[model samples]
Target chain A: MSPTNATPPSERTRVRRVAQRGRYDRETLHAIVDAAYVCHVAFADEHGVHCIPTACWREGDHLYIHGSNGSRMLKLATHGAQICVTITHLDGLVLARSAFHHSMNYRSAVIYGVFDIVEGAAKAAALDTFVEKIAPGRSREVRPGDINELAATTVLRVAIDEAAAKIRTGGPRDDEADMTREVWAGVLPLAMRPRTPIIDAAPSGTPDYVRQWHEIASANAAV
Target chain B: MSPTNATPPSERTRVRRVAQRGRYDRETLHAIVDAAYVCHVAFADEHGVHCIPTACWREGDHLYIHGSNGSRMLKLATHGAQICVTITHLDGLVLARSAFHHSMNYRSAVIYGVFDIVEGAAKAAALDTFVEKIAPGRSREVRPGDINELAATTVLRVAIDEAAAKIRTGGPRDDEADMTREVWAGVLPLAMRPRTPIIDAAPSGTPDYVRQWHEIASANAAV
Candidate 1:
């Protein structure tokens, strides 16, 4: 199941240079977007082209990102405008035998589509998704958004249209001759580990969600 | 001091919304670009707009990025083309008392400029900078690029030109009223850690530079 509601690869999101890195499988799209906490979104304004990095969350078929209603990017995105949202995860640094072949083992996705403003029940649900994405059970632990708080937020959803995932994994690929060089070449795994959460005023210790995230990430690092 | 050769925020690179976070300081530019291993470069063709995330290096006032000569992004960036390069570092998750004020602490820079193709020894030097950027002394340890490797690669340099660094640090900024809520709110520090190097074949343990980086990062996390 490539795209249940896939936009298919148009000229927009196609991975041209390293075509092999381009993957359109449904799982690839979900995995790339879900793993990353933020995305660099690009769009054109009268000032040529611009890219802004913002927090994002991936829902079932749609990706949700919200901002202050007064913000310019949110205003423009909600008007059914075209935009490009790209998420990248630097997995490891590939140190090739030759400087020219040095590459990053990463997973990135670029999705292009128009946005629609989500409101009412859907808006509240999307907010939960955003919090939960940060930590599995975070949404329930935090105070729910009140009426005025929800009113101040502007949530936009973009269908996972024209999606593409570019990934590079494993060890360096050096020329057979260069492979034997004495120079050390290998992978330095790059990862984001959750640190100790700093609470403002906790009558009751650190939250369970934060602690769970910390433990899982710590365990992974030890292994 | 600001841009010595500042591209001056054209309507293009100008930070319109939340203008307070937009910075034009020279040190800010160097700090952000130098810290990241990759950048999302955006440009337009008849096909549409594209953003390809690739390895990038900062040397003096010029930002260097290279890829296969056949790559479309490198092709467009080489010949005095207009492009946007953005780098973002997600520092933490700001769990606020209210959802409306939920924000992330991050540092991001968006640079706008036209590209110039680097040639001769400058191209080779830029590759060295790229490797050194990954690990301070990595270039010397790795085998130097051969003539064929340099010939096959295309390097582009964009002047520091119009650049803006938007940053949000510290803890959550919650509404005064919401501050008294019973909900747990705080910052979960997000950091990227370099894991142990997976060496290909090193007669003497890992190189000093790689081990140094790992130790410094590990020590900081312990603090």
Candidate 2:
């Protein structure tokens, strides 16, 4: 996003705890949301709060999530209820000389808003966005959802009204006394990647987009 | 746990949607929670619902999470606020002939209960558990938290009364009509691994447990 289009902090979006780690920029939030494959959506009622993990994609300032018509989460969210969508990518494990200093290096984002259920032509376009965002150029290559399929699905999008991104990096910050100890302390890095593309019996070999993404992921994993 | 230690479903734990994916067994829930590095915790209040991602560990029927004493979620949860803790591990990406059939293979668990703040000796033991759990033997080798360090942290646990685990595996389940299309369809396996370990400048050589876990993670990625 342009500098002028950055997200501003709201009362609810402000990071009250560990305030130093919080980021209030649209670019940071967008990058985190776009790179993540799934998010945990939370909604509540008199019964209790429910946090459901589901796939999502970011397009512009909006985040789109879809589910079957029969999904309890989809049904509850479509009624214009408030929701919290959170995505966290664990980067590594922080090892410290003292137990209390142990932590993890990570990047996370939380978005707050009510979802608007897409319908008719808009829903179709949003579903297309989900597939295309998941894998570049694949949406144009594959068959789109049929009428029955579209009717049975529910797509919802929440515009970025309030959001915050938090990140932690670098090696462990051990205490001065503990740092002198002989125990080793540093980050044990963690990463996510596609293992390999399993081609179906179908005629097409692996598509370039898929293969290219896999290669890039594999290369990153190697370092 | 013994055969008699099964986790029976409570009123809220019963899987109302996609019932087939739900598992009420303690063994299943334990395995899913143990493998996950983080969980998205959901809670509601007069203001609204919030989802925060944080580190967690499961031991027996109890799940423990710790945060800075000033954390909003930790404070609310310590005061008997109802909370939902959900952990999800994305295993693979399912590519189907049609967009509607696209999905991901994952293992997830959500536990609902009130958190009890751990204190004194029990808090010390729990912090040890957190360390041992994250990297098994590292706790024994390192010094335990001192007075100030322990006082600065808040550890909380929720004994499981109602919990559910949902998992999806295997290849894409495309419709019979669409399966005949000349489209590649299957699962693109995804996994987590520790990148080359960054040995702290102070080292007794990388511990066997850490090295062994990295080797196993790398071996799995190779296949």
Q: Pick the candidate with the highest lDDT.
A: 2
Q: lDDT of candidate 1?
A: 0.79
Cα lDDT tens digits for candidate 1, B15-128 = 776777777776788889888888998787766666778888899988888888998888777766678899999988988876666788889988888888999998888888
The segments of candidate 1 whose C-alpha lies over 4 angstroms from its true place after superposition are A1-8, A214-222, B1-10, B203-205, B213-222
* Fraction of native Cα-Cα interface contacts (under 8 Å, chains A and B) also present in model 2: 0.74
In candidate 2, how many clashes are counted? Answer: 0
TM-score of 2: 0.94
Q: Can you write out model 2's per-residue Cα lDDT over B123-214, one digit (the tens) per residue? A: 98888888887888888988888898789899999876589888898888877888777777777788877776666645666787667756
Candidate 2, B106: how far from true, in Å? 0.5
Best-fitting candidate, measured by DockQ? 2
Using all chains and alpha carbons, the TM-scores for the candidates as numbered come to 0.92, 0.94
